[model samples]
Target: MPEPAWRNEGTEPDYRFTLANERTFLAWIRTALALLAGGVLLHQFATELDPRIVVTVLSAGLGVVAAVLSVVSYTRWRANEIAIRQGRPLPFSWVLPALAAVCLLTSAVLVVLLLIA
Candidate 1:
């Protein structure tokens, strides 16, 4: 495939930085997959949880978060690559905190469901 125009704009970054950025991107992808799997499993196997609507909504929320994370991860990886090549400070993102909040909410909801069951 042809290289992106942005890749030609900046000096080539060190291979180590490039590889590390790739690894980070893969890690984010893995996390997103895991969340998606959790959603599917919850929907399929957690038949005992009451308030089926709430469970369904939570499962769908996880899938949505996974989808958003997958997109965000790629964008973050590209931005990081550009910054590294240009010798600029990495851009900050709210992705981590937002992900944490979602995780905490999911855990709390699960705990409540378990308690109620």
Candidate 2:
């Protein structure tokens, strides 16, 4: 992985593009960190929901999303780097839609839990 970053396989892309890709990957990592924090806070502080499992499930969901994004973001970054080097089209990812769906579903569940509480 480290070697790939330094490899000069294809055309050397601009430092700006590589920097931008690094920033994007950092952003995703930051998002995952925030999600993990939110999950911890909810699990530790929001203790009134009935069935008790609601909070647990919600926290777990956020954790899972965070973990997934942490992994997939690397893959996305690598793909973008490869595309830039090869001068090929970058791959479109489904992560955005999938993330939105996960968040929306989690929000709905939270709303229901709040109502029930």
Candidate 3:
């Protein structure tokens, strides 16, 4: 079998560490999928919320975030793998803070919306 890029570039990392990195990547992908679903559901089925424009904006924001996260996941996975091979500190990713900010904004928007509704 042909070696993957990470496999080819570095000494083999412990299997457990590589598996953990894969899990983290999968988790990010799941989060991205959830955001995509939420955006689609809100846009298509959530007709009762007032200021429907707010809902639309929220939906679009989530979708954009999802797209961004999807791209981030692969880059992060590769960086972490390279770092592991190089025996360097794990590379930092900005996706976490961005994800947190989106979640907090969504929660605040929902809370204010519920209060008004």
Candidate 4:
């Protein structure tokens, strides 16, 4: 029988690692969907607010960030999987910090808009 791609010579396959990566990707996608939904709600339901500008800006920003993160998440997962298969160290340092910063910025913007609205 041919060895599974996730298994290396003389070692059991790491299904845990593959499953964890899949879970992380799904989490990112779910987060992106939530952000998109929030944007849609803000644009459609918050029409009576005094500061439409802030709401609109925040919603648009969140949607764009979510979309970007979704793409980044998928790309990162693929890269990490490839690296693991090839016995190379995973590339995670850059993506982690960037994603954190994006979330922080989005939260701060949302807070500011809420305070002012």
Candidate 5:
């Protein structure tokens, strides 16, 4: 693949920082995969969850989140790389709070489902 133009614009960052960024990117990817797996497992093995449609929607939501996260992870990594190379403060992102909110909402829904079941 052709190298990105932005990569050529800035001095190379320290190897340790670059590797750390890569690791963070990988962690995001792993989280996305875990969410996807949870969704599939919920749909396939959660036969007892009430309201089949709710379960289906929740399962699908997880898949969607996973897909979004996959893309977001790459973009965030690129942004961080660029910032690092340019000697700028790392760019702020909403991913953490957003992820926390999603987890909280998912858990609350599951709790409600369990109570109802």
Candidate 6:
């Protein structure tokens, strides 16, 4: 029989790790959807009829970042799961911090725009 991709030569596969990775991917997807919803809300309800340039820029930037993060997170999670199964060191955990920074910066920009406009 062909060996499972996650199974190593002698060690038992870690199903828990695999499941956790899957969960992480789902969470990223949720985050992306939330960002998209927020952008839609800003475009539809929050912004003025014409919409400020900053508002449109920030919303579009956030939506793009979230979508990119979703793809990156899923790919990284799969790679990490495969690495763990193969007894290799996992990749760095940078996505969360990057996402957080994007959110913070975007919020700051929005606040500044609101105050000025």
RMSD of each: 0.7, 1.7, 2.0, 4.4, 0.6, 3.4
What is the TM-score (0 to 1) of candidate 1?
A: 0.97
lDDT of 3: 0.90
Flag regions of model 5 displaced more than 4 Å: none
Q: How close to the true structure is residue 65 of candidate 6, measured as C-alpha lDDT? A: 85
The estimated TM-scores of all candidates read 0.97, 0.93, 0.88, 0.73, 0.98, 0.81
Off by over 4 Å in 1: none
Instruction: Assess candidate 2 and give its lDDT.
Output: 0.89
Question: Across residues 66-103, which tens digit of lDDT does each residue of candidate 4 receive?
Answer: 89878988887777676666667788547667767877
Q: In terms of TM-score, how similar is model 5 to the real structure?
A: 0.98
Task: Write the candidate numbers in order of decreasing TM-score.
Answer: 5, 1, 2, 3, 6, 4
* lDDT by residue for model 1 (8-78), tens: 97898889999999999999999999999999999999899998888999999999999999999999999
Model 2 lDDT tens row, 12-96: 8999999999999999999889989989988999888877887898898899999999999999999999999999998999999
Assess each prediction's global lDDT (C-alpha) against the native.
0.96, 0.89, 0.90, 0.76, 0.95, 0.77
Best of the candidates, lDDT: 1
Better of 2 and 3 by TM-score: 2
> Candidate 6 residues 1-117, lDDT tens each?
996565554354578877887898888888998988888777666565333766787778878987897889778877777777678888888888988998899888777766766
Model 4 scores worst on lDDT over the 10 consecutive residues at 4-13
**lDDT measured at residue 8 in model 6 versus the true structure, 0 to 100:** 51
Model 4 alpha-carbon miss at residue 62, Å: 1.3
lDDT comparing candidate 6 with the true structure: 0.77
Candidate 6, residue 32: lDDT: 90
